[model samples]
Target: MATYISKNLISGEEIVLTAKNHWLNFFSKDWLAYCLSSNEYVITNKRIVVKEGIISRRIVEINLSKIESVTVNQGVFGRLLGCGSFTIIGSGGTRETFRNIDNPVKIKRAFQELVS
Candidate 1:
């Protein structure tokens, strides 16, 4: 009954993802546990790097199973432009939020593929 988790890949297996959530860029185990349990993920360099404005401080990775739900949030203005945000809920331990994204439909489809 929980959502959100983080993890790392090791020897063809994935380890849990942990963070302090104290200062961006810096990371430590803030919670008790974290894991991206599913095998579904997105791998778009330009998307998370340039378009998303995320730094290389961490790798471009996310666990599809850890995701609770995918939401496309369009602000009043964003709804007009058709560009918006992505809200992902992981197990009980982790959460990821992305903004000003494009082609959310494709992303949703990817998640569907993982579950189906």
Candidate 2:
């Protein structure tokens, strides 16, 4: 299936990186719900896009110029498992957190490369 990002890309925009929820999510209390819902984080040359849910959907898109900061948080287990959470803070003070994501540091780095 075509990704939410692909269908929405504008001229000159290309995806830099894409990340999904980590395998560790299977052990969480919301495992079943997590499995039912899909979470995606996509970074492009011009923006960051997050798509969540299955039957229902929640999408958040932030232009690179409007991003203030990206923060990664990991516990010992998460560090060992290569999964964690990243928070994106927008210029308008909007904060969005995506948790249990694989290689969150890589996502942060990808975003840094685009905005820097």
Candidate 3:
């Protein structure tokens, strides 16, 4: 299926990595909402994009040059399950966190490679 990220890419931009919420998210406190909506994390050659919700949508984009750091948080179960949360901090005090996402480390590493 075509995603919000794919439809909005700028000229010469290409997707580098994509991640979705892990199955463990179904056990989260927001399980009902999680089931009803979808969340997507995407890294492109030029930026990071997060798309949330199924019907009513929220999209956040941060330029690669603006990203300052990426941090991952994982518990015992998360480590075993290969799912964790990623916190991305960008210039101008922009901070966003994606929870229960699969392969958080891979996502972080991809972003780091793009910016570095």
Best by TM-score: 2
Per-residue CA lDDT of candidate 2, range 18-115, in tens? 99888888888757646864677899999999998777788999999999999999999999999999999998799999889999999999999887
* Local error of candidate 1 at residue 58 (angstroms): 3.2
Rank all candidate structures by their lDDT, best first, as comma-separated numbers.
2, 3, 1
Q: Considering every candidate listed, which one attains the maximal lDDT?
A: 2
Which residue runs does candidate 1 get wrong by more than 4 Å? 1-56
Q: Rate the local accuracy (lDDT) of all candidates.
A: 0.40, 0.89, 0.87
Better-scoring candidate (TM-score), 1 or 3: 3
Screening candidate 1 with a backbone cut-off below 3 angstroms (N, C-alpha, C), the clashing residue pairs are 3-90, 3-91, 4-90, 4-91, 6-17, 7-16, 7-17
- State candidate 3's TM-score: 0.90
lDDT of 2: 0.89
Per-candidate alpha-carbon RMSD to the true structure = 12.7, 1.6, 1.7
| Residue runs of model 3 more than 4 Å from their true location after superposition | 29-37
Candidate 1 vs candidate 3: the lDDT winner is 3
